[model samples]
Each structure stands twice: as C-alpha cells, then as structure tokens.
Target: MAHQASNIPWNVLASNLHWSELKHPGHGDLHLRFKPDQGKKLHYFVEAFIRNIREHSYTARKQYPEHYNPPLPEEVILDDAVVCKITPTVRRWRAQRKHPGFCRCGSGILRSEETEHKCECPIPIPPEERTAAAFYRRYEPNRCYMFFETNGKAFYNLEIVKTLLLYGEMDTIFRVCAYPGVDLRTWWSMYQCYCENPDAGWDSLCRTALLPYIALNVISCFPETWDSASGKTNEKDYRRMRIYQYMLKHCTKSGMTTEVATHPHRQFFGIADGQFKRYGTEFRGPGLHIPYPYGLMPLEAFLNWDQVVESKPAPADIPQVQWILHSKGLPMELVLEIMAFAGYAPRGRLQVPHDPFHPENREELAKYLRFCWEVLVRCDMMAVALGMAIPWRDLVSNTLVQLLSCVPRRWYTIPDDVDHPESYVFL
Candidate 1:
C-alpha cells in the first residue's frame, strides 16, 4: 500500500497545481491502475474530486461574495480525504442505479416534483480558461486568436470557433456562422435550434458582424506571393474567395428578406398629410419603402445613382461623407477597399477574414482608379512625379478631405540623382 501510494503521480495527488497537471491528458489511462478490484476506481475518484471542488468554489463565490479564495485540494491530507470519499461511496453508487430525477449537473437529486431548486452547481470552466493553450497546440502558427474576452464578456470563445472553422460539419458551420450575437456558444446553440426548425426567423444584426469575419478568414487561403502579379498564383486563395463571395451574397439576401418581411410599416401622419402634400405630391403615392441592399460591396463597385444618372450630374450632387464627419458607423467596405487599393495585403486570411471584395468588377475598378488618383493628389505622391508641389485645395473638393486623410511630406523632393530603389518604393 505504501509503495502504491508513493508510485501515484504528483498530479493525481493534488488539485491547485498547474491546470495542465490537473487536467493531465493521461489521467484516464488504465496502466496507472493500482488494484484489479479497483478497476476504473481512480477515474471515478478524480471526477468526484473535481465535482466537489467545483461545488465548493460555487459556495465560496456565493457565500463570501466580497472575499473568497476558491478551495484547493492541493494539500496531501485533503487529496487523501477526497480519494477516500470517492472509492467506496461513489463506486458503490455507480454499482447501484443512478438516482432518478438527478439533475444532470451532478447536483443532488430533486427533493420532490413540487420542490423548487436552483441547482447551484458551478458554471463550466470557460473555454477561455479551460483551453487557452489548446489552440496553439492544435492549429497552424498563422491562425489568429482574436476572441479573447474584452471587459467581462467575450463575443466568441477560442475553442468553439476553432472547432467551427477547422472541423465542424458543413451545415453546422453555415448555420452558426450566420448567428447574430458575439457569443460563440450562443451562436452554436441558436444554430442547433435553427437547424432543428428552419421556419424560425433570422436575427439580422448577425450579418453586420459575421460578413467581415468571413472575409478576413478567406484571406488566409492567399499565399505569401498572393499580392504580387508575377509570382505563382495561389489557386486556394481564388477558390476560397469565390466561396466567400457566394456565401456572403446568399447570407445577405436571406437576412435582408427576413428583415424586410418582419419590419413594421410606418403609419402615414394623417394630421400632417395636407401640409406635407403642399411641398411634394410624392407623399400621396404608396408608402415609400427603400429596399435594403444585399451587402456593402467594394467601394468602387458600390452604385452611385446620382453620378450614374442618364443626365451627367454635377459633382456636387453626390451625398456628403457624413459618416466621417460624425466619426461613427464607418463602413467596413470603404476600409477594405482602401486597404486593397493601397497595396497592403493582409497577412493570412485570418487577419482580414470577411466577404470577397472584387477589384475586377467594372464599377469597382473605375472607383479604384479614381480613389488611386485621389490618394496620389491628397498624399502629394504626384508631386514627386511632377517635381513640384501643386496647391489645388480649391480645385479638389473640400469634402474629399473628410473621406481620405492627408499626411504632409516633403520626401517627394528627393533629388533626381538619388539612386535608392528602396526609398522610392513608397513614392
């Protein structure tokens, strides 16, 4: 007995040790068995020990409120006591039938059907805590872990996301990916529920956040040489981008349809109808409803009705960049287009996972060219090519300043004889 006790692993004898040790992967091995009669006894002991520790932790958190160090079974005597309590009593219970109406949480069985109980069992150790290092152990180095808790809440947890991105079933991934909230677990649960019943309505807000993440993820499929037009093209990037575009389009349409159908129509203001009609006859027509677009497309691809009208509209007819002025609700598409045009290809798909933004689309390409020119003028990059700075503040619309930031620089004045190829790259 003494030799067997001495041979027991340090991890099996303690709890407050490193969590890695407490959750030692080999703890389930039967090779560590002590006695033939005690078959699987150690496994039962460890589980019961853990359950007790969690219960104690909950009691401390609730009762002490202000100050409570979670109980530890690190002490040798405590481990001995826990081990002793589990083997005979817990093992005997296992031999007999499980108590009927036992709360699956491992809490005591329900007292009676009429009696109410809150089932004060502890919350599962959050994935952020349970599997902090699991991602590094399992995934490629380039994979980004962006779901860490900010403030007290996490929109997504690493484990569930890893599973969804790398190994989840196709249908499940699609369903969960469309969930609206930040919580991955909730997204997963809602996804399961949605799968079980397809008639339920979707939550539109999910698309607003999910699209960008999907786009960023697809970027990982791009290779190191992805940005260069010359080197070997990564077929994987192209395929993934195409898939992302299709999914995003489908998701946008589905979400939009649901939103439109459920949205409550506004009642016409009867009292003000006569006064409103004096200013415009358009008020007398059917209730005005602007159809929402599928998704925010690439900047250049986005339609500008005022600019595209059959009669060439004046430049001043376009809508002002009020979002920039307000410094709120900035469009993700605009930022993505800026990055694309600026030649700043993101590192891996994980860095900028979201829907595909096509530069090749005629409208997008035209916009890209215009923005490229605007960027050159605003940054004074053209001055380097011209050999002199041209002040055209009046000619350039002042509102353009609101959309693009200008950083003043004199580097363009480098002497013609300067031979540094590296320094001229930015110019």
Candidate 2:
C-alpha cells in the first residue's frame, strides 16, 4: 500500500493473492509469501521474538533491552531443511475443526451445531465463498502464519496472533515478527529519510518497507467478526505502536479502528517535527512525527494545517483520495482526469462505487475504472470498494470473492498523548 512501483506489473500483481515481489523505496525488491498461523509455528515464534524485543508476551519480545541481548541470526531461524524436517501440525488442526456445512435454509450465513445454528441474512453465498476467512482460504486454503523471504531464505514473518475484545466488539491483534538479528529499530529510525540515501541501507532495513502490504495481505482475510486491530507495547515503544496504529487504519477501509495499549504513564511532550525534516520546536522526540494523516501521499496538497489535525478521526476523514493518488503513482493531471470522469469534485469526498465490478461502471469510464481497479488490487484496498457496497451478496457475481480482505467495524485515530501512555512517542 505504501511504495512506488518502479517496475511492478500492477495488472499481473493484482491477479495473484498468494505471493508478491515489489521494490520498496528502502528495501529494493522483496518476495513475500502468505502462510496461515497454523503450520510453521516456530517461524512465527521467531517473528514474535523480534517484534516484542523486550517484555516477553506470548506474541512479542522476551525481555527489556537492558536485560536481554537478542540471539544471533543463526540462533533465530532454521533454514528450509531444518524447517521442513519437522512435521507440520496444520493438517491435525484442520482435521480437528470440521467444516460447518451449509444449512438447508440456503442463506450464505454460517452457523454451528446444525440444530442450533441460525440464519438471519438470506444471502445464498456458496460454502467456499462465505466469510472473509473463506475468501483468504482460496489462497492459503491451508492455514499458515505468513512470512517474507528473499533468495529462498526467510526474511521475517507477520501474523494475526490474537483476537482482542474492545469498544464492545472484537479487534484483531497482529505483529510484524521482528528478530534481534534483523534490527527493525534500525529500519524504523531511517525509514522517513531513506529515499535521499535510500539505496545505501536497503539490505540492512530487513525489508521492513514491504511489511505494511504484507500485513494488509494477511489481515485482509480474517473473519468479519474480527473488526478492529489492536497493539500493545511498553511505554518506550509507543511511537512504533502509534505508527502501526495509523498504518493499519489507513490501509483498511473505513469503520476499522485501532487501539495501542500500554501501562499508565504521563505525557511528556517537548519537541516534534513535520514532514520532509520540518522541525518542531516543541521538541518531543524523533522517528517519524510528520503529523500527515495520510501515510505516504504527496504532501503538497495539505499545506494548510488549519484543515487537518493529528487526531483519532483524522485518518479516515476522506479515505480514498490520498491512498488512491499514492498507490496509483499516476501523474497529477492523469489522476485529475480520472477523478473528473468518475464525478468526484476537487477536494470533495471521493465517490465509492455502488457496485465496483458492475457492468454499468464499464459503460462509462471503462479505461479509467479499469485503472482504479488496478490501483485497488495493487494496494490491496479492494475492501474500500467492497465496503461501500456493504451487502456484498447483492452484487452481480460471487467471482469478486477472491479479491476480498478484512473489514474493520468503523474507524481509527491516534489516542491522546496526555491520556494514553501508549501514545508516547520517542526520538
């Protein structure tokens, strides 16, 4: 969702849901493969170790930096031979969970305990086409925890490690499996300024740039019930926690909210900075504090700070415009023309198609719609389109199921720095 595709084939890339190879501004090119959270459980542990780094959680680091020096690279991961040697328990897990058969009522809605399952929605989606989980199953069909690889060796991994209940609904907690050997802290520190010295540190960044999309690819398939995404880190890592909070919100459709939690701590704001090295005299700390609501779009459009603020409601305020512009990477004029054809006014709310793949859309802006769809597929933002057309079953065909991703309940924003300790960022 964040990089420029210098040599990426948008059309072909959209067609494949399993794996992707894209050139990141900081990481050059990386090959990413998606696996369910079942098989390769040890590899999942490796990623968890890296991500947690300190204060070991079942899904994160083992100890604080002062007490624990992370293990060496050799100690972290097993090569293909060592990994393949161990028998995967995926089959056993899958075997244990029986497919809840479709009810005779014919509603696509899934129910458990045949006699007790209820069907409220009368939509007739085929068994395989049921939920977002089923949509992802089309790709990973086998349950796995996904990881990144280059040169046939594992680079890193990410997975939906747990489901949390928050704001009266379910939130999915995911991690970008970090390891001590790879140095994700290095990647985070230099990410914002890298384009200027981009090529020099590509390898050392551990391909962290591809992480956003890799995350988008995996979380996109979680069941609809897993609404928002949640994260937890110590007070020191709050900035990383906040940045991830925003990234997940921007990449997913509207209605998805994010909350990063930490133990109680008082806010200590001092200095801050804006995009492109614009320093903030307020002096808080440094990493990426460029308060631009949109992740990586052209900043020229938002010179007026009066219009936008860094708050909880900020990220999803407009939704499509910034992400579309960044992901498509099209010339400003071409983007304007496409938007004009689509009946969107300058700086107005971008129109969400009533039916994304509907024929009526093809009759008018045929080539332009095609380009927009390509952008959606490349950025894995099809949920933006599918979300607007809520009753996905009412649409023309079930074929669009393969293009599915996760749906968050509503929206996300940054927690107040004064109140939430997790919102504390550092330099």
Candidate 3:
C-alpha cells in the first residue's frame, strides 16, 4: 500500500521564528508567526530590528537633545558605577550557564530563553557586594563619579552602555559604542580622555574613528564595487589605498622632506648647516670628536630628490616606494636590502671620492661614514653579528676622522650680519 509523506512542523523546520500577539481572545484566535527557513534569510529580520531600535533611539535623542536622558540613576556615575555593576552581572550570568543544573533536562529546555531574558533585564549591583563603605566611596565628593551624572546622557542605549562599562577600560568602551550616527559629544569626551592620558592601546581607537571616516568621504567618487585582475576590491580597502596615495601626493607636492621618525639623533646630522653645528671637531676638543657623522647620512640620501627619481619602476615612473620609505622611517641600508631581496637595484651609484684631502671629498666620505654609525645605533653588536654579519667598527672609525675635518665652522657660530652690542670677538 502507498503511504503519504508526513508534513514537517513549520516551527521545528525553521531556523528562527518569532511569535507576535494574538489578534482575538476567542477559541479560534488569530496569531501572527514569522519563521525563516535558512539562516541567511533571518539577516533582514535581525538587521531591521537593530535598525529600528537605533533609529527610534536616535530620533528620540534628537527630538529632545538637552532633555532626553539615559536611564542611569542620579546617584550613579554611569562610567564608573555602571561598569562596576554590569561587569559582575555578566560574569555571574556566564558562570550560571556553566553550572550543572543550568543544562539539566528540566531547566535546559528553557535555559536559552531565560539567558536572553536575563541579558535584556536591568543590571544592578548585588546587595551583598554593595557595602556601606562602597556606597560612601562611590558618593565621595569631587571624584570621577560626579562627572558620570552629568555625562551619563551621552550613552543612549542602556544595554550597550552597560556592556561597555563591564569591559573596565574606558577607551575600549568608547570604541565599541561610538560608531557612525553615535553622539559626537560622547566621542569628543572619549577623545579628550585619550589625549590627556595618552595610552598606546587607545591608538587603535583614534585611528578607527578618524581615518576611515575621512577616507569614506574622499572615496565616494568611485563605484561601490571595483573589479581587479586578482579579484574585486571592497569599498573600504579601495578608500584606504586612495587615502594613502593622496597623502603621498600631498607630501610630494608640499616638498616635505622625510626624516627618521624614530631617531631624532640621526636627523641632527642630515641638513648641511645642522650637520656641522652638532658634530664639528672644531667646536669640540679632540677626545670629543667621534669618528662617525653620528649616523644620519644614509637616511638623508634616500630622502633626496635624486635617489627618489632614479629608483622609479619604469626608469622615470614615480612609484610609492619613496613615500613608504620616508613615512616608515626605514634606514637607507635596510631599504637597499629590501630592494635587493625584491630583485631591484637602487639606481644611483655611491659617488666615489677623488681627492681625499679636498673638503668636498671629505664631506662625501663623512656622509658615508654617518650611514655606518646609524646602522650601529639602530642594531646592537649581537644583532649585527646575527643579521648583517660584517665588521662595521673599523669602517665606521675610518669614515669619522675623514668627515670631521670638513665639518663647517660657520654652522657653529652666530651669523656675521647680526648686530649685537653684547657680542664678544674671539681673536
């Protein structure tokens, strides 16, 4: 005998289902149920709910910018107090899930629903944890708690605000909470805190907030999707590259000379006038005369127009290498090493010294000597042994003496044109 195929229950078959209120109160009351069969199909439902809540909250805040207040108590400072309370609650909730009874047959069936309800519930500091001392401490005058009362309104969603506070770090909270359409006042407050405190971890937060937004505005000209030979590039990636290129072009146009961002000591010897003043043998005694140009020459040459133009991809085509090298503050030796590894030779020949006694020749040699000094300064002896594996000390010393004689005297002295009555002439 032929058998009929059994129909699957709609609720059981669907991945996600939502039930709304019943329309009628009688025996045959109508109910609205929405179910999504595929997981991806539920994306719209989730997105719509999130968007609706966000829009409603934003609109409400806008309607009454000054009067619309957060749900924080007047006595509590949202930043400190909320974080203290919410952190323990989240931890307890997590711990409860790990409890043996939480997953047993009776409670397990309803566990997920209960957990969801708990997440949506108002968070409070447990009575046991809230001692008289703690309360008194929280209410202490002229503390960070006072600012929380005035600033609590900046955080619109209580749940998100509570979650952020539970993280303990103020900068982390700001990053997760402050996105596009978030209140600028809240962002500004966090930004000021970062500026004042100057923590390294907050750098990621600052970059996310400032750079991407600026890039988006500038890259709106391009289509949302762009095809490349390898694959399609997303809008965000395309915008980032465009911003990088724009910055490179701007730096080039402005004639901004690249300096070692890390080693300011190296920069002290790069410019013609600055070089002689800092390291000239005439300015200091013989014992004070260090052989090297204090380690700055290679970086300076790499930054020069001649080297940048020569190292182009197509013999004349200016690539972004110059900008990259400059911005990263990578040393010339390292740059050359990278180029050699990549099968490219830096174009310019190291100009050979003709007359060793000539001032110009000595200057050129000094520049080379400075490069060696910089290498040593950047890496220790062991690192040099492991990496470069060369004897640099002898070479560095030899170059130093040759360059010292050429250090300009005028660089160390006051200008001849200056009319100072207090000036004393040294005969």
Candidate 4:
C-alpha cells in the first residue's frame, strides 16, 4: 500500500479496491483494478455522501447565485435519424453491460481474462483509470498533466481523473481531466437537471463519490505529506471549484480545515517533494480541437483552405508538427492571423499559463463580453465563429479589440447528432 497521511480516510476507499494484473510497455506485468464490489457498506456511504452535498450545494446556490449570460437551452434536441441509430447502440452497450464495475466469474477467475473458458459476468472491461501505463503520450518536461482516462463512467461507476505528475517542475502543480461516460447529447439533457435543481447535481451519486476521491488521490501521490501538503484560498471565482473546496474540507471527513469565514477560496493542495523518473512520452502541446473547412472556413484562411480541401492528406512522411495538419489541424494561416490580431510582433513575449489577466479574470471578462454580445445581437447579426474563441490583444492599440471581445460559449459545436468523445470539444 502507498503511504498516506493519518488524517486522510484512505481506508474509506481502500476497503473497496481489489487488484488485477496488467501489461505495461516500460514495466511489464503491472496492476489495475475495478472499483467496489456490490455491497451494502458502499451503498450507505454513497447515500450519506449525497445527502451532505445536496444540503451544502442548495445553500451555496442561494448565497453565490450563478450568473449565466445566456441560460441553458430548454432541453437537448435530437434528430429522429440519429435517434434511430444511437438508440440501438446505447441499448446494445447497456445490454452487454459495458460499464467499469467489477464482476467475478463463478470459476474464481476474472471475466476480462483471455482464458479458454468464456463464461463471465456482465462487465466486459474495467475503467481506464487503473490500467497499466502503456502507450504513454510524452508531455513536456516538468509539467503536470493528466494521462489516465476513466471513460465510459456514469451514474453507476463514478468518473475519476488521474494526473501523471512528472519530475522537477510538474511536481509543484497538478491538473485533472475527465470525459464522462454519458455521450454528448445525453450530457446536455442530464446537465439541465443539475441546473434546474442543485440538490440533485449532475448525478449526485457520482459527484458525492468524486469529491472525496479527488482529495484522496492527490494526497496519496506526494510521499512526504507532512512537509509537502500546502494549501491556499481559491481566490479565483471558478464556481465549480468553490463547491469542490467546501465539500472536501467541511462536509467530508478528510481532515482538511479552513480558518477563514468565506468558503469560496478554502481549498487544499499537495506538491510532491522528491525526485522521480516515471516512464512517459516527451511533451507535445495539448491535443487541440480542430475545425473542418466544410464550407464554414474562417475569413483568415483565404486561398490555402481552398487548395488544402482539394489535395488534403498533404504529405507522405509528415513531421510531428505537421502530422495531422492535412487531416485535423487548423491551417498555419489561421494560427498566424490570430497571433497578428493579438499583436504578437516578431516573437514578442507570449502569455504563460497562470497569467493573471487571462484565465484568472475569466468570470469578469465573461461578464464584460456578455455585455458586448448583448449590444451586438440587438441588431440580429453576431460574429460567425461558432465554437472555441481565444482573444489575444486586449490592446486598444490592436486593430480588432475595437470590434469584438469574444465568441460566446452558447455558439455550440452542436453536431448533426452522433456520439463520439470530441464532438462537443469546443465547450
């Protein structure tokens, strides 16, 4: 077992886990396992967990009061053609039982095992979080990034995000990513329920389990918890983080305490304090969402979009930078146009992550942009960039800031109706 702090309720989770072997590329025959077996203890724990959170969130919603510039859609709309196709796939998946739960065979072996006998239980494969680290994507040195994905997680099997914290710099910070088991369209409809009633969150059963797990997972990674367990007031107004901090420290018996009266910023963090070399790929930039030209190409792409559309899959032996450019990458011209709009003159200083003026000011900026969007939409035409938008020059000195602030979040990347991971990537 990994060493854990005395205050942490590690056993709350440990009792639920069972181990299985995996094959890793760097280190062979490692272990990964599914979550709890169907037991009454887990049932009661999850119940009490949801009750505490529902009370807390209901109170917080009244006090904080979220500000949505534009409200959530009345409900998700699905096309009949897509409904015909996806309904069967979802049914087939459910019938086969493609969830992350652990189910044992009567033969005292696992169902996922490649044995000659195939008599097994409902679950086909376990969630991806516990899988042995194989096919690792290299991140840039000293940067913390998530690698493990607990995909296909839902109300039954809660999603857990795992970040692979690298040596030196990355040890000082952490980040987690999760793409839920619910498909895109289903997510919107279910998300609407959470919006309507905070007491019932985006599947409160999963969320109640998730909050305690985040603190447990982060603390377990850092070896010297006594010295390295650092914390701060979450000064930024990410509303989601506000609930996270409050629930972890006050509601859950995780042993974290907050001194201040204000609950928004009361959060804890752990920074690793040792030197370690874990196997992973070298850094590439974040896997970005790409736009296809399909007639809605941006004004900046000009002639290149036309030519690329004609003879795509451009190069034979493409370099790393150009690998998917012919297929999914935004044209080099579009990249330059935005940088030019931002006034990035001939390799001037670039914005670093955690630059206070950008993401940190997102809420205030969102409010200001909402005001701007309200003004523009009065005339009935809005800017046509229908997905993700990153603005560069706050510069009154720049040419475009005079005209536009941002592309609104509601200009959704609404697909023609299908289910795949990145279809709603823009949000």
TM-score of 1: 0.18
For model 3, residues 258-281, the per-residue Cα lDDT tens digits are 111111112222221112121223
RMSD of each: 32.0, 26.1, 33.0, 26.6
lDDT of each: 0.24, 0.23, 0.27, 0.24
- Runs in model 1 deviating more than 4 A are 1-212, 221-226, 229-241, 255-257, 260-427
Which portions of model 4 show Cα errors greater than 4 Å? 1-11, 14-41, 61-427
Candidate structures ordered by TM-score, highest first = 4, 3, 2, 1
TM value for model 4: 0.20
Off by over 4 Å in 2: 1-209, 221-243, 246-427
lDDT, residue 305, model 4: 30
Which digits, one per residue and each the tens of the lDDT, describe model 2 over residues 1-427?
A: 2122222222232323322114223211112233343223322322332232211122121212213233333232322332233212111111221223222343323222111123332322332222223212111111222211110011111111100101100111111122222322232212112233322111211122122323322222221212223322222121212222232222221111110110000000100011112221221224534444321222222222222322212112334674578578887777767755653432211122211112333332233322222222221111221121111111101111111222222112234753532221110
Candidate 1, residues 270-310, lDDT tens digits: the string is 01001111111111214423222111223122222112211
Worst 10-residue lDDT window for candidate 1 reads: 264-273
